[model samples]
Target chain A: MISVSKLLCGLAAAGDGLRYDDPSGPDQITEQRQRKPVVVWNTTKGCNLYCEHCYAGAETEPATGELSTAEGKRLINELAAFGVPVVLFSGGEPLVRDDVTELVGHAADRGIRPVLSTNGTLLTRERARDLRDAGLAYAGVSVDGLPETNDAFRGEEGAFDAAVDGIEACLDAGLKTGLRYTVTERTVDDMPGVIDLLHDVGVDRFCFYHLDYGGRGAAVQDADLTPAARRRVVRRLCDLTREYHADGAEIETLLVGNYADAAFLVEYAREELGATAARRVYEYLRRNGGDPAGERVADIDYRGDVHLTQFWQGYALSNVRDRPFGRIWTDTANPLLSRLRTREDHLSGKCADCCYRDVCRGGSPLRALAVHGDPFAPDPQCYLTDAERQRDVPPADGNGVSEPAD
Target chain B: MADMRERTRVERSSGDGREWETFVRQDPDSSLRHVGSVTAGSEGVAYEQAATLFGDAADIWLCPAEDMCRYAERPLCDRIEDAADA
Candidate 1:
């Protein structure tokens, strides 16, 4: 999660310790505290709508061999024991399962913050109320574009209306709601309108997810944003975020699925806000570690299989069914899982040589694997120029500040 | 308690200038409190605008600005004094 809001607004919400008054000075100041990664639990492999870019390849029917409600509750308990701070209930469509509220309630009871990620088709007013009553902290609803485009992408006729209604229902029910827009070349042009629509409808948070090549997404990998296009899009998003923020709007903007966003933001700040602000941005990026996939992020599908990320399928370090989730998560014995822990030593090619390797961390290893067939290869989505990559990154020399970007 | 902090809330005004009253709560069990208002063209749009305009509250409520009712023309404190005098 590249917090566009934090980077743009300089607000310290979570994980970031930088004070607004006295920002961290140049020498690489590392945040000493390490909290458990937010874990994603796919509550069910059942979905009502068949989205074109469904990462789970979800169909209209439920998948065979999902974890039972009892097993899910046990898994939640194990995750809480593992020190996971937040558990995000994801899909197929999390709302498809009848006992989702019960599962969320159980997780919350265990003191783990529970969040809901859904397609928004089934989130009725009553259901949203029940979820709030059950202790759901936040709910993210996915929307690709306006009614026609969104409905088309969802592969349903009434999906757009239902989802918009769902957003209203969640708000009416008092459920803190957000919008997730998966950015594709097709939908990129619609971003401006999407932003306006979200503001008009009163959705506070908007996440722009760069296309990750996985499952159905692989079919349209060629349609992914070009480096130049991505830069333009990022600039637009940054401008909009700043505009809204300056006006005192509570709306937050975030970019996901791309670590390059951090580097981009750093460059943007240096160009616009000057050296001191840029240095603060760098500190925040370094503290957060641009990409947290293998190190901090972990996901479990409905079938109990664990992967580095929700988009990463086919590779499973272990399953919760075979052993407890805590054990599986900490067990670095698996070759891939072990390699992911110390990726710096194993990052191949340009990624290893890049000066900003610490910030990019070879970009998304999953994207690298998807396009290059090697998990350690440089991320195909890396948008930095050769000049930018080759620039000597000055070490944090005490409280020293580096020269401003030319 | 009423928020007395010096803060500037960015309001999303629908071009039409009509607005809706908005309310929010910290959690399910908490009572709803009026956060602010959102300018929107219609009630549906008002709900959306209100939802986005409010800060990180757990729940939100929106109704047309015109629909709200009032008990008296003066302040509650002033009303209590008048009733005692009467």
Candidate 2:
């Protein structure tokens, strides 16, 4: 049901996109569905931080750049005009640009809600207040996991505290805030600890994103979670959800994985969830990774070109300035972001048969095509022998636990 | 929340008009059309001149007839196939 709603909004936005597969019907009529009120606009092509699994694109070195204030403002203005009620700000670090507040403030003034996606190390109380005063509504801090796990994935010391501080600052400013972790082979083990940290910081609503590789991480994808590794992570996440829930805490976990178990888990996830819970679930799937091409997390090659949300060194977006990836959204020929809309894997190569294909967003078509030479191929780990599976603690599912509702 | 389409926005250019003259990428594969100014004639002649120019480009099969005028004005005109025969 959660997946269906997301598909509805996405498909409705496609405007008659469903007709592509329904050959027997009229050629150009789109069924009316709920429209997606928000869109993520990647303003900066470069990032300042270079974590092990970074996806910001072109973080090969300590480079710092952003979409010029001029064009950035243009984007915000256009988004407001397009009637996209919400715009998300992301980058190597959106704060790195001196003019980020300018765009965020502008969007907010125009009655367009603005959300900031940041690694969270650079945010200070003063900065947070400024953001709030400028009308920033929410902030998403990426803290991955606890110290040991987080440092490895974030590739920076003290990022843990920086992220916490960033969240605290936003909270201080009365902005609704949240945290997210890209569950991977390395950090999935620390799911329980990560949840505890979220509670400590007063975040009742948090999102967990399964690790995926598209642009930058494609360079180092083998380090990506194998299926066996992913199962281990999922089981633990499941247990943690149970542990927290049994204790009478209200905890919600948005699972983002290969969807290897998604078909079965969808009903399980909604056993007794609400609208907020449902929305949390939808966002988990919406923002998670996988490229248009099958590029693994470790297969990222920054020097190469890949279509990114923004024009990064790699990750191309066809025509960044004029078209919104017409090829990817050109009716229904695309199998990447618009996959959920068409309900078929037009470009997933051979992945359509896998039950998880529908759930995992086919991971990333570019990544799969890059690492496995077939976007439709099951994640390389899925086909391995059972003997290859691990006999350790399962991954955290976040549903087993519940934090006391604040 | 209000509907997403209530706001209106205009894309802004960063530089002078000369910037476009220097930056407009002539996609080598674009269709050619004729939109350039046509010669002024009698009272009803203005629209007729423009219409005639439009007709010249419209006769082409695959080429973008609207673009024919731009190329025709440049030194590249010699290279443009008028399709007058085709």
Candidate 3:
């Protein structure tokens, strides 16, 4: 996930752009970017609402072999011991689990920053307080669109009300709260309304997700936005983010499941805000290391199977119940794992030649593999123009001197 | 688990060398605690970096590291270090 608000407003306001690492002051050690991956634990496959494009293919009933509370706690210990930075509790609805609060407390007590990702139907006022008391750092509630649309998407009549209320509950309970919105062609027209709703609800952050073809999402892959439509929405998000930042609204904006947005943001800035501004944006994006799925992000399903990313359903790296997460993550003997660590050499098609490949890393491997059989194939969703994809000529530097292509 | 605040303390040198300190409050009524710091060239970037790095907070405030003031004798790390050094 790239924080559009953070990348643009954070650096743009500071008048500084290139630093990538955590700042070390006098007497502080320069922090090395650790290989520790942010782990998302899918607590259960049980969900109350069934959305059309549910990525987890969640059912109303819990899946078999879902981690026991004891198993879940043990995994938290293993992750903590492994130096995992964040453990996001995700599920068909994480709140559906009875031990979720206990698990959140366990993670926080172990110094793992605990976050919750849920459909929000189950997050009641008291439940929100319970979670906060359990030391959850943040709660991300999925709100797909307006009341009617969101309800239809969630496949429940009052899901929108329940979700919006859940967001309110989290906020009222003093927990840091944000909205997670997945955009499809159907809901694309409602993007601006969604932003307005975010403001109205006083959400602290908004994560706009590009559709990923996983689980039930595969069924709706045709509903995924066109490259042009995706670009239009991104441009709108950038404009809205800048407007909100300029007005000093306290909100964070981000795009998930896609890194092309980052590249497009830089390109957009170059055309609208001039070269200096574009360079600043480019430097921030570069530092963020776009599309850090298999490398920096990983997922442990309810059954303790570790996958390359949360969206990837198959190809388990190792089961946390069988081995420590740290060991499994560091074991590069798995050919795919090894390739993911340094995939630059393996990226094919326009991705291998595009100047912005470093910024996008061939976009989502899961998406690529879904559209084409090859995980390393060029991302079909890349919105860059033919000229941009060709890499025949170097992008013009402000000074007009072209450096040799790598 | 290692202290994330301590773990996240490393700095970057690629762009602007300026650094900012991040403070977060878990609740509207809670006092702010020093969460972590981010290295950015500008104040706007610092604030955004602080938010991204510490998004769990209900409220976040960022100031250039150079602008922050502290009592050298009354450091929280000293207490933490005493246990470590003991």
Best by lDDT: 3
Question: Candidate 3 on B1-86: residue-level lDDT in tens?
Answer: 86444221212122114656566786798888654345567778766645543444688787665565433332212222224211
Worst 10 residues of 1 chain A by lDDT: A21-30
Compute each candidate's TM-score over C-alphas.
0.77, 0.59, 0.77
Question: In model 1, what is the error at residue B72, expressed in angstroms?
Answer: 72
The better-scoring model by TM-score among 2 and 3 is 3
Predicted structure 1, TM vs. truth? 0.77
lDDT scores in order: 0.72, 0.47, 0.73
Best-fitting candidate, measured by DockQ? 2
- Per candidate, the number of residue pairs that clash is 7, 73, 15
Q: Between candidates 1 and 2, which one is better according to lDDT?
A: 1
Model 3 error, position A295 (Å): 1.0
Return whichever of 2 and 3 wins on lDDT.
3
lDDT of 2 by residue, A188-212 (tens): 6677777787778777545666545
Cα lDDT of model 1 overall?
Answer: 0.72
Ranking by TM-score: 3, 1, 2
Once fitted onto the true fold, the runs of candidate 2 whose alpha carbons sit more than 4 angstroms away are: A1-38, A45-48, A58-65, A267-315, A323-350, A354-361, A379-406, B1-86
TM-score of model number 3:
0.77
Which wins on TM-score, candidate 1 or candidate 3?
Answer: 3
Q: For model 2, what is the error of residue A166's alpha carbon versus the real structure, in angstroms, after optimal superposition? A: 1.6
